[model samples]
Target: MSNLAILPILLPFLAGVLVAFFHKNLIASRIFSIIATVIHLALTIFIFMSVQESGTYVLEVGGWEAPFGIVIVADPLSALLTMTTAVVATAAVIYAPKSLSRIQEEFYFYSFFFLLIAGVNGAFLTGDLFNLFVFFEVLLMASYGLIVLGNGKAQLRESLKYILINLFSSMLFVTTISFLYSVIGTVNMAQAAERVGEVEQQGVLTVIGILLFFVFATKAAVFPLYYWLPSSYTVPNAVVSALFGALLTKVGVYSILRTFTLIFNYEVDLTHTLFIYLAMFTMIFGVIGALSTNNVKLIIAYNVIPAVGFMLMGIGIFTETSIAGSIYYLVHDMIIKAVLFLLIGAVTYAAGTSDLKKMGGLIHHYPVLGWMFFLSTLVLAGIPPFSGFIGKLLLLQGGLNQEEILIVIVALISSLGILFSMIRIFIGGFWGEADIMDLPKQKPSLAAMTWPVGILLSLSILLGVGAEMFYPAVSSIAEYVMDPELYIESVLKE
Candidate 1:
């Protein structure tokens, strides 16, 4: 169990170093990454099984006691996220060869990829707040390299903006940590949770909380801080974009969830209300952007902002069911969004453009891709019998239980907006008229791309159909997150 707790992080770090040293040999680097990710996945599975049997596990790094030495903690929530990270990383790795150019491949892309995985795993498992900040830097530095690997005009322009925005956020993150450490006198998350209330700095804590919020909100692409996302992300290859799409913003969301639930519950009434308003605005603005965009990738990127809003709404409502629904929706959105982005990439690869007006009659030639996109669209729209539907159902029920009528209305309206924008894509991009004589012909080899999309789609379907099983797991996670004592006691004994 102890090994399970650490291997998810260790395997990737070791592999990343090995890949970086052997960067000149692409084949060997790829093989090392693949093996490392597979091992990481196995470790996550083992940890999941252990958690299922024992509830949670804690590992004191270097065999030192907690509150003094570093610790890694795995409860249901972190374990589940770790598992999701593994699955998405595996799929992105598979999709990379087709998406990355040979020049990009020579730049140690695989090493950075594994390092990103390692960072995410560390973020999910670490029991220390300072370690979380370290992991965020690790991931951000790797992402910066990946985004600029091509060094094209577009890549450089976007990378500069990306680095600037993320740098500001990182500064805020460090400041927040400094304040937190000063207040609690410990960086261990469990100990901090235990000691935070004892501090006589309510006003300072509130200030720090707001600072932390700004840091994460930027990373999560919440409105007003979201402009950098669409342009920056569009410059990367489809695989990198898909990976960032699947995992990066969610890291911020996870931090918000962890901190708010564990260490800052005292400010819930204030913060939760603020979150509710931000969520409503975020959804409205994101959908409007999606509706206005003609670029397929940009549309998807804009839609992601609203998806985060939906999850935030669940958090703002502050109910057991609502938080559980948020968890479910997060997992659902990550898989579906990755599949959608990859599908768009495949279309761009095939048609040599992402402009909706320039694409048409794709359904006739690429029925498989069409059907996959259609199914994903339905899932995104929260259509019945899909993963999105179940999540929305739970969220709405929680809102109703809390008498948050305005939020309920806003949620439904935003969902309709998703449906409407997706329809625009379907009609104009896939099914609309195409000049058959003028369209350039190319051999369709979307088979390799289909595998990742298929895996994602299958998982979405399974989650929806197996809701009975998943709900319990989600509920358990929500309970664990809402009460930090369970986590603290496991990691730091009295």
Candidate 2:
């Protein structure tokens, strides 16, 4: 059992609570939040390195043991995601002080922000499915307050929709857990996987698998279930958007990735095949929404959906290269999406409107911002020499190797659509008639906004150009997914 494993979750919670006491002191609150996030990132990096050395670290809370008690498993997959969460959270926390209104700041914004990070970290580490549900609520409850911080009408309406959908999904999540526990007599994920493999009634487990997919799909906001995401995310300020865009939905994607690869692999022919097709349609529809939008925020929001499908396309393919590709894409997307939202936040801040038609000549005023958004567009669309390209190439190769021609063709076409939709913003916002509107009265200092965006975008470029450096880690993560025995043995045997 490792004490270090718990710190990613616990340290943030403690920092958040301490920040709450600084409600009357903004300087202290911001300083503490930034420090805590930086520390969390450093710790997760250290934990990730240790996990790389030993394969996995299983920590049983309160000296409890195995399936009988709470467990936190920091395998390569979870460790990688936890590290990414910390990095993204650090960016959001750094970006917040300049972006958030004084009223929003005076309230418990920093506390809520760190709480959200803690919840995300806990979700990544928890070995128990029930504890996973608890972490979900923790993050969602914190998000509800963050969403309504500006107290705007649009924020209230959209956040209510966001909350109700999550509540429904949470209820469904609990019911699924209860049913699974009744069947296996355990909610510990590693134990459940072991029991699931031994159970003869593959039919009921398939139903459970499908039900679990439905629940996570709702949160990941794939296709038909994705309507709430664009609207809800669009209402929040850029920092909140960056955080949610970078981390939240990835948790749902992570859960789906974890469960299917671990607990529900017995009926892959049925379950995975269904997931593959849904992922295909999700990409198609998501790109369509991006093309249909004039609002840059909605366009960015819709773009989030298509990438979700792409990441899962790798998972649904369930091959080594495919899974590795998805993991890379997941980490890459987190950084790039944060970069995108931060850029758009800068975009809307300078333009005074999210409507692309009302924006023009941005390239003249902010040449670096325009070029960054333009390159990010290329990255998002999987262009060569960019991060998205490597993952998309692997995914396409996997699909073709599996002779999933329809998915391959759909993925290629969707990339083109994604490219056009993003370029629409560049062309409309940066290249056209210089039809700029009055900038926002409360615009932030350019350096404050661009620093986070530039750093994240540099990381995205490094991710692509330096893909070889990440090859071993992503490959091992793929192995863990392909062989749950590695995960189960590490947890129970330890």
Candidate 3:
């Protein structure tokens, strides 16, 4: 079981190497990528089941002792995240051939895609802080390649901005790790958590904590640091945008969750207060951006920025229920966001434009695509019987439990904003007079592209309807995360 933890990371890395060398054939590359994703998904499920039966599993890598060599750990939180990453990556791979340019299909797209998966898997599974940083860079490097792969002027310009911002953040990340190492004398997250309280200077720890928060905030597209996301993500192809929309910021959020729960719990009250305010502001700002944007993709991009705030709000509330809500919402947002982006991508492919102002009456011609878009948009807006509704209810319940009146009000406002923006897209893009003449005579392959999206939408519905099962799972994860002594003991013990 301990050995199984490594497969998710290793499989993608190995597959990437093979694809980079020998699988230049698009068919072979696609098959290999799909096979790799399927195996990773299966391994993730097995890991989740193992955790369900026996609790968290810990493996000291290379048979070396923990706190000296690297370790891989799979608590419920890590397992759930790994599973989510695998599912999303698989869906993206399955959907890509239909969406990617023929050049991209033949070149480095599959290789880089698998590398991105490996990086995400590494980030989730690593029990060491420095290892997390390494994985983050790996993901970023691959993203840089993908963003610039098409070589359009817009792609080049936006990719440069994205690369520069991320590079700066990477530098800050290195500084934070150096300071953490200087203070704790170890990069092992479990050890850091154990010793963080005993560090000589509380001020230093606080400063480091804030710096690290900023680093993640930038990566996660939080308020004041999110300006680059919409513009940059808009430059990529729909398939790339959909994958990034689903996974990238979630990785940052995941890092923040892990770091806060494990390493920076020394000043919970302060961190909680700060994150709460940030969450409120992020949600407000992101919704406003969505409201003002005319481009459908940009609206989705802006919406992604604020969703982080909602998740962070749960983390800030810090009750058992809030933490559980945050976990559930994290998974929920990942799927819904991906589905929406893919739908938008399909819409753009059909219309040759992303501007809602230029699109109209698609429902009359492309009923399947229109309804898919409508359903996904509704789900994203937190309509009932959808995953978003369940997540929002849990988060709102947590806010009420804490008597956080301001947060409750802000959350309500955000929901309204989401609904309005979604309505704007639906009414303008799908419900007006038929503008089918401007669109391509030949539609993209709906069956190939739509099925993966259908799978994601189904999962979202299943998560919402099967809340009885999921809530217990989330609660168990929250409990494990909040108390992590068992994780520490398992990893460090002889």
TM-scores for every predicted model: 0.96, 0.98, 0.97
Per-residue CA lDDT of model 2 for 1-494, tens digit only, reads 38888889899999989999978789988888888889899999999999888768888888888989899888889899999888888888788887888989989998898899889989999999999999999999888988898999999999999999999999999999999988889999989999999984387878987888899999898766888899998999888988888888999999999999989988878888988988998999999999998999999999999999998899888898899889989999999899899889988887878998888888877788889999899888988888999999888988889889898899999999999999999999998555355655554457888888777888888888888888787888887788989989988884
- Candidate lDDT (C-alpha), each: 0.85, 0.88, 0.86
Clashing residue pairs in candidate 1, if any? Answer: none
Better of 1 and 2 by TM-score: 2
Model 2 poorest 10 in a row by lDDT: 435-444
Model 1 residue 474 lDDT?
Answer: 86
Give the per-residue lDDT of model 3 (tens digit) for 360-479. 897887788888878877788788878788888888999999898899899888988988998888888888888544766665557788889899888888888888878888888888
**Clash totals for all candidate models:** 0, 0, 0
Spell out the clash pairs found in candidate 3: none
- True-structure Cα RMSD, model 2: 1.5
Considering summed lDDT, which 10 consecutive residues are worst modelled in model 3? Answer: 435-444
How many residue pairs in model 1 have overlapping backbones?
A: 0
